[model samples]
Each structure stands twice: as structure tokens, then as C-alpha cells.
Target: MDPTEVNVPDVKDMNIDNITQNTILINSQCESERVKYLFERLVTHLHDFARETRLSTQEWKAALDFLVTVGQISSDDRHEFILLSDILGLSLLVDAIDHPKPPSSTEGSVLGPFHSHKAEVVPSGSDISSDPKGRPCLVLCTIKDPSGAPIEGVKIDIWETDSSGHYDVQYAEHDRPDGRCVMTSDEEGRFWFNAIVPVSYPIPHDGPVGKLLKLLKRHPWRPAHMHFMFEKEGWDHLITALYIHPDPYLTSDAVFGVKDSLIESLGSVSAEQAKAYGVREGTALISRDFVLVSDDETQRLRDSNALAAMADLFPGKKIKLLDHLPVPDLD
Candidate 1:
């Protein structure tokens, strides 16, 4: 049966109850009850959304072309589609809907395009600072309970851009290391780092996503932030990004990563504390703690990690590991 020829209810004549009744009727016959129910709900909502937005023919065609470009540019080595979704704020919305963490816990943000699996894991107090010429930063981090008591033995995987606001992936040939650190907290639940202060930077604007953003009159920049993933044996593994409170794009990040709870002031560290952390004078530091809820679904959390790891595992069949190796900065 042709859907266009069917006597579907018109937008002007539709009400919530009528839509609900139609949805129930649509679910009455199907090979899979689950799929029938799901599609019924989805169709009604999608129809209502299109009607409410008054979707235009030109706008819809543009949207389809944008998505086609996204798929066209994607490969095993690159996921421009995910990057497109991220810049459009769709990725964050999906993450929010799928994983509703505790209100007091750290909020999840966009898992940016450059997340690599090859980061070297370091222990507490180990310096993973990549470039020495960049502005010095001492990150004093803690993991604790809601009452503020330190929660020892928590592991934190971290990464950020350099003073120039470029990630390692951007300078594929330059070989400079932008701050990428993986460390665990000590017995006192404290982990301090000596790193170059990260700078705000634009998202990759040379790609299709950038062109789309230009068409929409949106910038291709994200606010200054440090990515952090916290994990513990019995606690929920939290993946989040912390934004510098004073970042200019706090209200207008191109990637829409900014969240009110994730913003924290990068305070001035006293000379004594700086010296204790081996940070020289005049260097700035940011201090913040993450709180994680206990993880009851261990298998599900492990499965998610396994999936991410597998997705990024192998390069093309014709390419060798060394062939895809990033150039190291010999200078």
C-alpha cells in the first residue's frame, strides 16, 4: 500500500489523543511486537516534529545532503559522520538521553574526534606534559564522595590541547605532543599534574562539517577544556570534559560541550603549594574533584569500553602499524 495514497490524518486535524489512537492501531499487526510498538511511537513523534517545525523542502534537502556527505567521508580510519553529529549537538543529546547520570555527578560531554587508544598510562604524580615551551599548568585533581571525603584508588584518563590549541592529530607531520595523560589517584585520592595550559581552539574546519557550519553561520570553535574519564572497581565509569570557567565560548561553544555543572574556576595556587607540586613560580593551576556514582551494571560498562576499543583497534588491511604511525617530535 502506498503511504501517500493512504488516508493519513492531516496535521491540522490531529490531536494528541488522535495520534495516540493512530499509534495504537498501527501497533496492532506486526511480525515483531517490539518493533511494531517502537515504530508506532517513532512515526507519531516524527510526524508531529515535522509539523511543529514546519520543515521546508529546501531545508530538508540540505539536511539530507549534509548527512550524505558525512557518510561519504567516513572510513575505518576516520569518522567524519560522528564529528558532524558532534558539531551539530546531536551526539550530546543522544548521550544525555541514553545515560542519565546522577545530578551531582560529573556530566558527560562530546567525546571529540581525536580520542586515541594508544595513550601511555602513567601513575600518580607522573608528568605527562608534552610540550615544554607552552604555558605551564599544574592540575590538582581529587575524587571524592558527595560529602567531600577523598575516594582513593580512582583512575583518571586525561587529554587536552597545547598552548597553540592544536591536538596531535592536527599536526600529523609536526610531531608535537599535545597533553595526553592517563593517571590514577594516590591513597589520598589526589592526583596532580604539571602540564602546559590548554588553549581554546577551533574544531577541524577544513572538512565537510566546517562547510556546513559556514552555511549555518556558526563558528567552528570549542571552549578551552580538559577531557577526563574516571573509573573505579565498583563505581560508575564517568566520561566527561571540564571547561575553563572564563572561556569566552562558555555560552557558545561550537561543539556545544559547555555545561553549567562542568565549569570550574581555575584558581591561583599559592607559591608554597606550587612549589610542593614542583610547579615553578608564575605558573597557573586548576583544581577540581570528580564524583562518580557506584556502578551496579558492571558487564554493561565493560562492554561499552570493549566496543570502543574494538572500533579503534585495527587500521586498513593493506596498511601496517608503522605505516600509520604518527611522526615523533625529534626536536
Candidate 2:
């Protein structure tokens, strides 16, 4: 495309009254209709916000500088931008819009920035953590379709924090996997594992997003939960977490990722029961059955009048689920 052939309005003598229109006019040359529409709307909203707030030039510069700092602090293992989005509830909102599920299906939640591709596959009933760090827990889960039929061979990735409310990756000298593992469901669609009772923890609060939270007088605590990502051929991938019932932060999750349907109680396990589950005595138990929607069904729901009305901005372009992490070799 020749630069001289590009159609755009002249930028001379631009003022607040015409700046937004000129910006949209120039952006109209975008080749992709979806991108063009998105940016046009984005510009309009941004300009309207500035005008309505009477934003000063100094405040705008400060906001840009804050974003720059966010980028500067991000790394391969740490995603500050994702934290920013999570703190602002944008991540959960986007997830809700993209993944509309049937009432029977498990609800999706925000995938925090700490998921690692380094989790190793372990056999069912094996302990995810090498050494016990908190009250032992036996997690028994079943994967089933919406119709209640067992779905076998669903890959499940699980992770959680230790008693002190810290993940292995949060350690400065983090070098080995702990409190996380991957496994597959059995013929009965059942998978059981030994884990710690997850505790309520603070999201990483030493960054710019934390500063923003402070400015808003919001706490940075999340409810106790265990992360799970399930994947199976022909099924819509599900990224969700099970919240511990009676958690103080259940109604005030920092990331707004909790759903009433996803909450489960931790019950006391007797010595015989713990032995039966292949865990030590005094261990607690949490049992849950997850219902997955098939890919075809998910697409149909996305196109339905209910969901389409809320997320029809990108017609014909389905929102892709997060890519599945590589299946680790079974130990």
C-alpha cells in the first residue's frame, strides 16, 4: 500500500473538538473490520472519559508512566499486565463474555498469573507436594458431561498455595515444582489426589496494580481455592477453581473469580476413610463433580440469542480457549 494513496484527514490545527474525529478517521484505514471497529470504539470511549473527567495533561502523563512501569516489571514467569486486568475485573468479565455455559456446567474463573508449564504428571492418589506443609487433604473429583455420563481421559492440571499462602513459584529461589501436578481421569471419570488445604492468600501486591488497589482502598486477598484446568478432545476446555466454603474472602475475592456453584465444603475424614483414600489420618476431604460442555454445544450457546446479544461484536470469530499445556510424562 502506497503511503500517498492512503486516505486520511489533514491533521493541521487540531483541537479537542475535532481530535477524536480525526483519530478515528485515520484509524478507519485498518484492513481488518474487527480491529477497526474495536479501536474506533476504544478511541471514542477514551476521549469521552478524558473530556468528561476534564483530565489534565499531567494526569495523562502519569497514567502512561504507570503503564510503562507495569511493562518494565513483567517477565516470562510474572505477568504484571494480567495482574492489572485481574485487579480491575476485566479478566473475569472477558471470560464470562467468551465462555457462556449451561446452568449445569461448571463456571469458569480467572486463571491467575501463576500457572506454570513445568508441572509434572503424577498418578492418581499420589501426593502433589513432596513434603506436607499444611492440613492434609484428599481431593476426589469426577469429570462428566452435561448429561451425567462419565468422560474419561480428561487431562487435569491442578495447583494451589501452601498453608502460608504462597505458591512454589513465589519463592525467590524457586527451582522445583511443589503444590502442583497434572493427571488424567480414570475409566470412571474419577481422579483423586493428596494435597494441602489451600489457604486464603494475597495476590502479588508489590507492583503497580497493587498501588492502584491501594488507591481504590481495596484489599488484595483471594479466597482459599484450588486451580484446575481440564482439557479433552471434542470438549470445550475449562479453566476453573474450587473455592473453599466458609472462607472469609469468598464474597470479596480480589479477582472476582468466585461463583456460588464452585464452592465446596471441606469435610473431616476419619482414619478409615483417609486410609481408604490413601492419605494419612486427620486429612480432610473435598469431593466435586465437574460437568463439561462439548465444543459443539458451547458454540451453539455462543450463537444463541442470550449470549450473542452480549458478545456479538466479533461475529463468526469464536473465542479460542487458552492453549493446553504440554502433557508431561507420567511418573
Candidate 3:
């Protein structure tokens, strides 16, 4: 029973097309089981999509070209590929699946296309805004554990758009770092910095992603928000955002990063009035606290899953499952 020629369609270079989809999924045998499974599933879905869409060779070539352009524009300071994933909602989906929010931990959001390790480390309440055109804003934050205890010495990296809704990366000659800073928490896990209140800005549409959005009739505006990357040894790194409440795009963030829990309120204050708080009188004030989970706490939560932990809710009493009943006739 020779199977290669029996069931296989007889044609020149027949395996090239794989139109039958019976081709054995070929992958490296060295890959782990999970990796192999993921690769095979991805291939299956992609091949199926091509077949179902009856994708023409021209369309496939166009997609390849589009990707090439995206790569051409991406560099050390820019990430056009990440921008593509963001607008397509894949970034948010990946984050949600990878970091499912446990208990009181802060929710994660997209890191966006513009983040740089070049941010300068500064003291608490230092003015990070080199763009004098930007409106002054005082941001105060505290990091604490789920048990309401302070987590000292956590490093907080803050970055946001200029008052004009433009990041430092957008400007080619802005050699000086503005609108970004790295600060550490005090003994009380408190840290603050002075900057501009971020404005809702459009994701750069000058590249292939912009063309895609134009063809799809979609907007690329991210709501007003700030980015915070909280990191410390032995603790889960927090990549999250604080979205300014009442932003017009809150309900429809282009990257799908908005969450109700992340919404923060802003207060307008005078520089003289802010003098009491030790800042140079920032125009807007934002005070919020972030909760981080320790590695041990995360492990404990994992060992005692949600359902297991709920056992205490009904001490020794078994909960009954309700029966499913068929729909009654309206007669």
C-alpha cells in the first residue's frame, strides 16, 4: 500500500500548492511540544484562511510588500511593526492572555510604538518637560502591595506625549529627552514628577499602517494617557497606563488599551498653589496608587486557584447547580 502516489494528486510540482491541505505539517523536531503545537496550529489557520479567501498571488505579494515597508521604517527609536499590531488589536490581545490580572494587581496595557531606555534618571518632583511649550502637570504616584503595605525602591519610568500630542521620537532633531523620566519610590513607596498633561494624539499615519487605516476607514487616535513602566528585582514588571478620564476616545481607544480601573482624574492648580506641595506650581495634578503582586503572592494565588479559594465562602456547604430548563411556549 504505497501511499505517496496513491492518494496524492498527480501533477507537476503538486506539493508546492498543497491545495489538498493533506501535506504533513513539517517542523523542527527539536522544538518543544508546546512550540510545535503552536506552530502547527498557526500554519493550519493561515493556510485555511488563504484557501477560504481564495487569495490571489497578487494580493499575497502586496501584503509582503506592505510588511517590507513597515520594516524599512522601523528602527532603534521607532517600532512601526508594533504600531501595526497595536492598531490591529493583536498587542492588547497578547497582553491580556499573557498577563491575566490576578486579584489587586494593576491591569496592563499596550506599550505603544514609542518607548526608550534612554530616559534620564531624575529625582522625585524634577521637571522632566524640556518642552517649555507644554502645559505644566504634577503627577504623584505610590506603589503598594495588595495588603496595603508600601513597596519601597521601585523604579518608575514615565513617558507621555508633549502638550501638542507628539512624543519625543516624532521629532527628528529633539536630541534632548523630554516628556520622559525615570524616578524611584521613596521609603513610603511614593514618587512624583512634573510634566505636561498628555493630549489625545493620532498614531503616526505616515507609514504603511496609515495607508492600511485609510483603506479600512479607521482612525488612529489614542486617548490622552500616560505610560508607566514599574520595575524592581524579584517583582513582576508592570507595564501599564493611566488614562485621563473624560477623554473623547476613552470608549474607543485605537489600540484597545483603555480600562475603567485605569481611568484617573486630573485637577487644575496654580503654580503658586502647588508651591505648598513642593512642585513649581504645575498646572494639573494627578494622584493615583498602583498595586504590585510579589512573586510569592503570585505563586500562592496560582496554587490556590480562584475556585479553590472560594471554598471558604461556603464553609463545608455544597452549592447546587441550577438545572437548565427548555424555553416555554408563548401561546
Q: Report the number of the highest-lDDT candidate.
A: 2
Location of the lowest summed lDDT over 10 successive residues in candidate 3: 321-330
Q: Residue 266, candidate 1: how far off, in angstroms?
A: 2.7
Model 2 is weakest, by summed lDDT over 10 consecutive residues, at 321-330
Candidate 2 regions with alpha-carbon error over 4 angstroms? 270-272, 305-331
lDDT of each: 0.72, 0.86, 0.79
Clash count, one per candidate: 0, 0, 1
Over the full model, what C-alpha lDDT does candidate 2 score relative to the true structure? 0.86
What's the ranking of the predictions by TM-score, best on top? 2, 3, 1
Error in Å for residue 93 of model 1: 2.1
Error of 2 at 265 (Å): 1.1
Which candidate, 1 or 3, has the higher lDDT? 3
What lDDT tens digits, residue by residue, belong to model 2 across residues 24-90?
8889888765566568779999999999999999999999999999998888778999999998899
- Tell me model 1's lDDT, rounded to 2 decimals: 0.72
Question: Which of the numbered candidates is closest to the native, going by highest TM-score?
Answer: 2
Order of models, best lDDT first? 2, 3, 1
